[model samples]
Target: MSKPEFNSLNAIFINCTLEKSPRVSHTSRLIDVSKGIMERENVSVDEIRFIDHEVPPGEKPDMTEYGWENDEWPELFKRVMKADILVFATPIWLGDKSSVAKKLIERLDGMSDKTNEKGQAIY
Candidate 1:
């Protein structure tokens, strides 16, 4: 096995289902479809089931700094940072995405002055 080229396209999919793993997630099935399409195009795809991790809610990049003892977003954010694309998969309820999804979006939006190698803002 060898490292992918620096220019290789990569994507990260965050499944914001409230349901834990070992259980079926229709949204994830939908992600599988998109993942397959990207894979066919030679894109590396990484999947993260958000519910399985302990990511507290906060506007800061790291909730731990905001008095949280444990925040998984820092580690998760690393994955988000490394990807060329981020696909957030969320289940809709009453015509709105799940709370978890909303929180995730907020966190992403709250991203501070971090930019990619191209000098483009990552949000």
Candidate 2:
């Protein structure tokens, strides 16, 4: 069978933090929101994404490459760009967006201007 067309259905929920004490871990709140969205949309009707951000400082324990650019980051970016809708779930820290979400957004800024070998933005 042929592969599904891009953007047929896609969504992402990136939680910035979930530390618990700090006004509740942002990830925890995001998961609740994500679950509701998935339920409302129905499991068979749409695709749902949940990006869990819960890691200690320094290199990512799940990482298996020299750097993110050479590893999962690329694939994750592709997924995000392919999505029809993107949701950024984060908490306010010191009256500002959580650092994790901020960094992810910053990383995504370059996606729009990029092009594939055939010259196509992921969006």
Instruction: Please name the candidate that would achieve the greatest lDDT relative to the true structure.
Output: 1
lDDT of 1 by residue, 9-106 (tens): 88999999988997888998999999998887788899999989988887888888889899888889989888989899999988999999988887
Global lDDT scores for all candidate models: 0.87, 0.53
TM-score to native of every candidate shown = 0.85, 0.55
Write model 2 residue lDDT over 50-70, tens digit each, in one string: 234322222332233434333
Clashes of 1: 0
As a whole number from 0 to 100, the lDDT of residue 78 in candidate 2 is: 56
Off by over 4 Å in 1: 1-7, 115-120
Q: Write down the worst ten-residue block by lDDT for model 2.
A: 43-52
Q: Specify the highest-TM-score model's number.
A: 1
